[model samples]
Target: MYRESLKKSLYDKEAVIDVHTHVGMSPRFFRQYGYPYALSVEDLVIRMDMLGIDYAVTFPFVDSAFYVNNTGSSKIETTTEYCNFPFELENRNMLNEVNEIFPEHAHKILPFLMFDPSRETEKQADFMEEISEKYPVFGIKTASTYIQAFVNDVEGKGRPILEFARRKNLPIIFHSSVHPEDPWASATDIVDLAERNPDVRICIAHSARFLEPVLQKADGLKNCFVDFSAFIIHCKLAVQNSPGIAIEDFRFRADYSDPLSVMVKLAQTYPDTMLWGSDTPFNYWIQKYYTGDGKLVEDRLECGYREETEILHALPEALKAKVAYKNNLRFLFGQDI
Candidate 1:
């Protein structure tokens, strides 16, 4: 009885199941800052524990070569010759490390296998299938910057990978940052895929940002949903555009051009279709500025996660429960949660 009560309390209306996280590194670009890999799953867990987040679907930031080893060297290096060193956050080995580190929490964490679909073809599909069969993985992750980060590339190399996911009954989460530089997993690209592969469950990271076309797509497509990772669920931040005319400008307030107000409105509008994600570490932007020559320690919990939890707590209990854990649980486990 106590266990049941505890489960009920933890899975309360405010309970959050973060759908996007990196247990190893930020996407490649952020790695240049000389910060140690924030993808440390242990560190992520501590942060999640502080924030009351029960589970997270982790995707390694991927570029084409994250999964390969040198021809002769038995030691696996985390980089590729085609791309620069340090590779993207989507390293497959990092997924292995995370699973190894938390065997018990492994099921709660869904690690995405990273692949450069254009380059890795059959080998990629084979590895993904093997891992899915051997371990508990949520799905696969692909980056849009692959084409943008390289030259002479057309469209995402993710189609073949998605095909493998379809065969395996897995979901693929794509990062659809509102920012324009993010090219590979744009809302249009993902929408096209979702339309084509109706069985594949696609979670668009960052609530499809200013991608109205993508947001509208979620309304009709049952398999599509948005992840609120970078958006401000807590405080108001400067928006790129006031009127939100363009997709990039839509960052602050594309829905109604009101950043602060849109979160609740959107949540109410699309309750079951939304998933809460801290998108932590990257979310440290909330504390980017400090008023001292010395370090000031703060809670460091992503404010967006906190705010979203509060907002979710305010919802009708049933709806809050549905969005907080049941929604993803249903999508992931059918009826377990």
Candidate 2:
């Protein structure tokens, strides 16, 4: 529906900004799960134009080396040699791709430096600082789970990065999860980080995997924002796994079965804190699995850009404007769109 509407110029192209998107390759995902390894600048820009989006906040993919040790796999030995400092090469490549290849459209592609928490904080900060000086680094992007670190390990891993962001006045967007087993980037930890450092702006990715606590905390924290990338898929998972949780948590009367309506309600309630994101290429590809007989089966869970755009279009005009782009402008630059 959005695809057709966008083609008809029903939406404002200049009013949409995707806050969560990735470029470059992830060797582990490609090898292990048969996911697409590459998303070039041209590829993303074409998709953005088709969906009537004007800008995108992007970073490189989490390197394969970070997952090899945790996944008990030795297939990426060659990749591991270069990926010791995760996202180092990928970030550089992204900077070069946007700045060199697509210089005309560089301003439209807001690039964030990927911060690796497992490495020495000072070293990582030093590299980020050096790169910022060379390129247009808008903000910082990091995933604690990808690096096998906890988001609230402030003293050990998170504090130095927060300090760096504060010093530079850069917003940090984290990859989060609500799954109990993977507590690395839970909403509780993310909220703790936000509470401790009120000066630094922080965005909880994927709406903290659509958890209730994130929405509650974000409503109160001025510096805390939430991006609903992959909202359709994650919200459904949230509702199916825990029925009536949305109604119980937010005290709303909407049916949890319909994630889109719930999303509109959430955005209306927290207009200032909600931001839009598509997660892009990731939302397009489905994970492949192996059967007992060694046959590869594709699980086509297809709630992607089309569905995400539809959700944005479904919102009331005033709320849609904020979630689509205005909120991200404030979150990233402390300004209006």
Candidate 3:
């Protein structure tokens, strides 16, 4: 058996799934959206394969403006940013490329198309509907950075996007965590959406780091999902936000409150409300701690995509199975994986 197959036999019987990730970067948004240093899809996939992640979601890092709206007028504004610092690609192209390269696992590699309403909301929505119909997509990627901060739609920026996906019965993934200085949607925004539209499935990316109280409060939202991506494993931005907390603090509870432990606690408490995700390539923790040699020795056993399956492997088989895949399976597929 291959490494992943063997690992599956040993610990996980169900196919592993990572619901959060960004496979490709736009050269167009490098300056604005990408980190000074970032990983590529080739690098990310190899790492995940080594770590035993069967499949991952490829989220595209797009400029917020373009993601919200893609109209002719918006295109003109977006073109100005393309001189050198901007990099963008069509969703169809990215999906087709991946499908061609990995046909068998292509369906496992879900792509949530990006959109910007200020420019091409209708066009992007149309494209999203087409992609969902043609290819199996978990949902659409919506950034609070553009809709909330730039557009100043504190109330409705993501509403339309979520509504658009709702019609297709797809989910909307939101970047709920706070960046260094950028202000975007908060947990409250997600809460409002969930309360307003119970039918829309929303995944809060990065578990809305440092906002556990807020997220816990929003647990009543039925279609809400949380992607435990890049929160616990030594993310520089997260460290910057909460200074004086060393990475070592996360491995042991006696030292301090580890974010990963907190996330695991949330998962254990509300198993059906969240899914495991690596947030590949762009997010440092997914590639380093989970895949590469880092502080999360336990996470290393997971290969790359940190999930409850790997976390509860040593427990009784029945409970282990529930944590491993059953909970997330219910949320993702509405039944099982």
Candidate 4:
């Protein structure tokens, strides 16, 4: 048998599913939304095949105005979130492109609606709820980090989406920036919403960069999950964020307080609430661009799905299976297979 086939057999036949990834995105453009990258199913499958990634949750990019609002205020310095960014209907249609690609592949590809509202307009959320009916999405992607940082709500920003998740049994993966006070999307903000909306399954992407902020509190919340897709890059960022420190000073440590070690422990801490993801080209590409290296895409665009996945080798087999795919299947499909 092939390597992946042997691994599948070893695991009692559970498929490896990546919970977060974008097929394509327009990093920059003059006309608002830029062009999506090469996100054809073939392109995705090629990468997934290399990593033995069986299924992926794919979505499109939504142009966002994150740091400041339309009202000339800094959300970072403000306590109350102000929904002042302007979004257009035209920008939300990347779902259509994703739908066009994944449907043919059957279980191999799954599509999620990326609905990030720019302002406190119930209409945008309402509009996506109406438009979502026209598409086939297994779940939804809400924003806190990579997208808009609007406060979670029921009428403005992601308000309309709450209804969709409530009605459709849809699991929502949030773009999180929870710890140390991310005005855009924080764990406190997400947990508050998750607590209120008990019916919806919420997965905090990257588990707030795999720190204790999100995981430390998930034991009490049955529907809250944590995904660690971009662990290495986040580790790299931790180093870069502390440039003046020596190389040896750049360590998450190898103890219980260490982020990676915490990931392993959380398997036993909140086993049912942990999952794995590969933010894919989106995470890799955006990091390159934001770090002022997008022009060197060839070097930086190297995929890290494997780096993210192999790190889980430290987990027990059962826990690895749970995070790799079982938890995702249970959360998204309500099936253990």
Residues 1-337 of candidate 1: C-alpha lDDT, one tens digit per residue: 4323433544454456776676664333343332223557777777677767777777664333453433233222444554432233344566667667666555456566655545545556666676566655656765544323211121354455667877767777676543343334456676666776678777777666645567777767877777766556223333424211233533334344354456566666777677666566555432211111222222232344355445545656676566667766555432346
**Residue 58 accuracy (lDDT) in model 3:** 71
lDDT of 3 by residue, 48-91 (tens): 67766765667666443233233222212344342211122446
Who is ahead in TM-score, 3 or 4? 4
Ranking by TM-score: 2, 4, 1, 3
In order, the Cα lDDT scores of the candidates are 0.54, 0.71, 0.50, 0.57
TM-scores, all models, native as reference = 0.70, 0.84, 0.68, 0.71
Ranking according to lDDT, highest score first: 2, 4, 1, 3
Better of 1 and 2 by lDDT: 2
Tens-digit lDDT string for candidate 4 (237-258): 5545522111233222334224
- For candidate 2, lDDT tens digit of each residue in 195-303? 7778888899877655666677877998899888776766655556542123345433445578778778778778899899988876755554332233444544457
What lDDT score is found at residue 284 in candidate 3? 36
Q: Spell out the clash pairs found in candidate 1.
A: 23-39, 24-39, 60-89, 60-90, 61-89, 61-90, 62-90, 144-184, 144-185
Model 1 misplacement above 4 A: 1-15, 26-31, 34-37, 62-91, 146-157, 177-183, 233-238, 242-260, 285-316, 333-337
Q: Where does the lowest 10-residue lDDT sum fall in candidate 4?
A: 288-297
